[model samples]
Target: MKPLFVTGSSPALRLTVALLLSLTLIFVDSRYRHLDFVRSTLSVAFYPIHYLAALPPRLARAVDGRLASEADLRERNSLLERENLELKSLMQTHQALQAENRRLRDLLGSSFKLRDRVMVAELLEVDLDPYRQQVLVDKGASSGIFVGQPVLDANAVMGQVIRTSPLTATVLLITDAAHSLPVQVNRNGLRTVASGSGLINRLTLLHLAKNADVRVGDLLVTSGLGGVFPPGYPVARITEVRDDPGSHFASVIAQPTARLDRSHEVLLVWTLPALSRAGELDERPLDAAPPAGMDTSR
Candidate 1:
C-alpha cells in the first residue's frame, strides 16, 4: 500500500519538492558544518556497497599482474641467452690472447730479433693431398702476402706461401716432400737439409752421414744458409735415428715444430736476407775430412 502511494504521487510535485529540499540543504551546508557530518554519515553507510562495486575491477587487475609477471620472465630468459652467447665470444677471445702472449714469450726467450713484419690470418681450409700437405689462408696479396713468405704458428714454422690472390692464398706446409729447409741441429750446429716426407707430422734430415752428430731429441733450427727463412727459427725435432749397416747413410726422421693438424691462426712473415756485396757467393773455408765410418757418397 505504501509503495502504491509513492508511485501514485504526481511526478512534477515530487521533483519540485526534491529540488527545494536540495537548495535548503546546500544553503545550510555553505553557512554551517552540519552537512559535513551528514556526508560522513552517508559514506559510512555506503562503504559496504562501494567495496562490492570495486571487487570485479580488483580481480581483473590481479589477473593482469600475473600475466605481466610471466611476460617479464620470458623477456628475462631471452636476455640471458643473448648474454650467454656474448660471454662465449669473449671467452674465445681471451683464449686467443693467451695463446698469442705465450708465442711471443717463446720468441723473445730464444733471443730472436724478428725484423719481419707479420700479418695475422686464419687457416680457411686444409688439403691432405697425400702428395702434398697444404692449407689455404684467408689473407691474400692485398694483405701484403706473397709467394715464398714464411708462415708460422705459435710453436714453429708451418709453411711458405706458394700462391696468392687478393682475398686468398695457398700455403705449402713443411711436411710436403717438395718442401725443404736449410736447418742446423741445435745440439752440434751440424747443418743439413730438412725435407718433408709427405706424411703428416713427419720430416726427413737429408744428406746426413751415418756418423752424423744428429740424434733423436735434437732440435733443428733454420740455418739461414739458403737465405729463404730467417735464421734460428724452430723447424723440426729429430724423432728417429736409423744407422743401418747395409745402408750408406743414416735414415733419420723428425717432426715439425708447428701444430700442423690443429693450427687455426698463422702469421705471415716478411723478411728478406741481407744481401752481401760478394755477389751471392761468399768464400768460406771448407771443413776437414769426414769421420772414418762415414760414407762420402751420401
Candidate 2:
C-alpha cells in the first residue's frame, strides 16, 4: 500500500531524519549505556591490520639497534686489546728498571774499595762474533778514553778498551781468546793469569800447578799488576780444578762474575797511577816485572 506523500517533506527532510536517529544512539551511549564491549571487539578485529601496518618500522628499528650494539662491542674490544698491550709494555719497562737499579746499587757498593776513578758509559752496540767477543761503547778518544783502558760492569771485569775513535770505543771482552788478565785467588792470595777461552762464561787459569792452592768456589779478583784493572775488583769464581799429570799445566776453569750479555751500562775506569812530573817511577809496564824489593806497585 502506498503511503500519502506530504507536500513539504523533500529529500533533505529525509536525510535529516536519518541523522537524528544516529544522534539519538550517541546520546543514549553517552548518558547511561556503556559501549566498551563494542570498542574492544572492534579493536580486537583490527589488531592484525594495525600490527601489519607498524611491522616495517619496528623491524627497521630493531636492525638499527642491533647494529649499534655490535659496533659498540667491537670498539670496546679494540680498546681493551690496546690497553692490555700497553699494560704489558709498562710491566716490562718496570722490570727493566728494577734490574737496572739493582746493578747500580752493586756498583756503588764496590766503588768504595776501588782506587780507580770510574766514569759511566752506555753500550752502543754488542758484537759477539764466532771468533771474537767484543762490544762497542759510547765513549772514545774525546772522552779521555785510550787503548788498554779497563771496562767493568756492576759485578766484575767486562773487558778492556782496545780501540778508540772520536766518539766510540771497541771493547775486547775478557772472554775473547786473545784477552788475558792477572788474577788471584781470594782465599790464599795465589796470583795467576786467567786467559780467555773464547767462551763468555769460562776463563782458563793458565799454568796452574798440580798442588795449586786454588779450588772450586774460590773467588778470583784482580791482582792490580797490569796497571789496567784495579785490585779487589772481582773477576771470576773457580768452578773446576783438574790435576792431570799427563798435561804439564793443571786444568782449571773459572766462571766470570759479570753479566756480559745482559748489561747495558759499563764503567770506564782509570786505574793507572798519575805519573810524576819527572816520570821517574811510573807503574810497571805490561811486560815488565816490579822491582825485587818490598814491591811498592800501585
Candidate 3:
C-alpha cells in the first residue's frame, strides 16, 4: 500500500546502516571486555575445517623429508660400494704380482746345486726368539718338507728347515746363535766359517786370520763345504773388518744379502733325504745317516 510522504532507501544509505551496526558491536566488546567465550565457541565450531585446511601442507612436507632421506641413503650406499670394488681390484693386483715373483724365484733356484727338486713356498710369519732367529712357512711334511732342508729367497740363502709338522714348518735363520755356515770371500775365495750374532741381519766371520785378504765391502758366498747349504749362493757382505794387533782375532761383521724382513715369499730346496721316504721307508733309524753316502760332491 502507498502512503503519503513515504521514502525508499538508497545503496549509500544501506552501507551506512551496516557500518553503524559494526561500530555498535565494537563499542559493546570494548565496554564489556568479555569476548573469550564467544571466540572459543567459534574455534570449536570450525576446528574440523581448520584441520582439513592444513592436511595438504603437512602431507607435502612429509613427502619432501622422506624423499631427501632416501636420496641421501642411496648416495652413501653407492659410495661405499665403489670403494669396496676398488679395494677388491687392488687386492687382486697384489696377488698376481706375488705369484709372478714366486715363479721367477723357482726358475732361478735350479741354478743352485741341490739334489732334490725345489718347491716354492710363502713366508707366513717370523718367530719371536731373541736368541735364535727363526721363521715359519706354509710348507710342511704334507708338502714334502723335512728338517735340514735349505731355504732360500730370490737374492740369497735365507735359512734351513729345523722342524716341521703337518701343515707348518720352522726355519732356522742364518743369524741364530746356533747357525754357522762355510762361506768364502767372493773377491779372493778366502774360506771362513760365517757364524750368527743372534741378530737376523748380522753375521760374524770366525777364524779370519790377521793377514786374511778379506776387507770391507767384500761379498761372501757359500763355500759349499758344510754339505748343509748350496754352493755359490750369496751369504753376506763384509761391512766391517777390525784387525787389532793386541787381539789375535780380527773382529769382522757382515750383513746378509737376502731381504729377510722384506720378502713375502721363499723357496724350500727339497734336499732333505728323510722327506723322500714318506711312508715306505722307516725314517727312525736312517734319519741320522740316510743320506750320508749320498753324492753331495758338488
Candidate 4:
C-alpha cells in the first residue's frame, strides 16, 4: 500500500477544504451568474426526469376535468329528456280538452233545437261483448234516468237505456242483434220495422212488400209507434234495396245516422205528452215508463 499511494494531509483538514470550496462556488454562482451556462446544461440533461416527476399531478387534473365534463353532459341530457316528456304530455292533454270542447258545443247546439227536457250524461264504460252493443252512462236512477229512456247523441238517436243502478245505467245500442225500432220513410211516410243486423252500420227492414216504395238514399226516422223512441228523430238511411221476383218481400239495408260507436256523451230525453185529435192531452202513456222496481223519486 505504501508503494502504491502516498498521504500528505489529515482527514479533518481535507473535509474543511471541501466545505470551503463548495461555499465559494455557491456564492459566485448566486452573485455573478457565471455558472449559468453550466446550470442550464444540467437542467436540459435532467428535463425528462423533471417532467416525469410532475406527470402524476398533471394527469390527475386532466382526468378530473374530463370526468367533470362527462357528468355535466349527462345531467343536461337528462334534464332535456324530462322537459320533452312533460311537453308531450301537456300537448296531449290540450288536444283532448279541445276535442271535448267541440263535442260539448255540438251537443249544446242540438239541445237548443229540441222541445223536450234533456240531460247530458257522459259514458262511463263500453261493453266489450261484440254480440251485445251496449254502453254505461254516468247517470242512473239517482239522476232520474230510467229504463227505456231514449239516448241520443248530438247527431241522432244512439240507443235506449235498458238497465239502471243507483249511480249508473246501461244503454242498449240500436246495432245490437236483439234490438229493433219502428221507423218511417221521411219522403212518403212508408212505415216499416228497422231491425238490427248485428252490424254497427247496417239495419234490416223487416217484412217489406216487393212493390214497397222504398229506395236508396231515403231518410228513415222514428215513427213514434214504439213507446221507447220519440217521433221524427233520425234513425237510419236506406242504402240498398233488392227485390227478387220469386220472393214476396224485398231485401232492404240501411245505415244508422247516429254515431253509435263513437259517442262519448249522450242525451237523456223526457219527451212531452202527445195531444189527441181534440187537442187534449191523451191519458194513454205515450212514453215507456221506468221499470216497476226502479226508484225514480229523484
Top candidate by lDDT: 4
lDDT of 4 at 116: 73
Q: Candidates' TM-scores?
A: 0.54, 0.55, 0.53, 0.54
Residue 53 in model 2: lDDT:
56
What 10-residue stretch in candidate 2 is worst by lDDT? 275-284
lDDT tens readout by residue for model 2, 1-298? 6659766779898899999987986987555425534543554565455446546755776787677876798998999999999989999998898778778978886422224588998875334356788886767677988767778998899988766665667788897776778899999899988878778898888777888788899999998766666678899999999988788668899999999877878999876443221122222224122234312111
Clashes of 1: 0
lDDT of 3 by residue, 1-298 (tens): 7767647888799999999998987987655535534544554565456446546755776787677876798998999999999989998997897677667767887332224578998765433455668876767778978677778998898888766665666787788766777889999898987877777778888767787898899999987666666578898999999987776668799999998777768988754342334333322212112133321211
Distance (Å) between predicted and true CA of 93, model 1?
A: 28
What is the lDDT of every predicted structure here? 0.72, 0.73, 0.72, 0.74
Higher-ranked by lDDT: 2 or 3: 2
TM-score of 1: 0.54
lDDT score for residue 106 of model 2: 83
Candidate 3 residue-wise lDDT at 203: 88
Question: In model 3, which residue pairs have backbone atoms overlapping below 3 Å?
Answer: none
Clashing pairs in 1: none
**Candidate 4, run of 10 with poorest lDDT:** 275-284
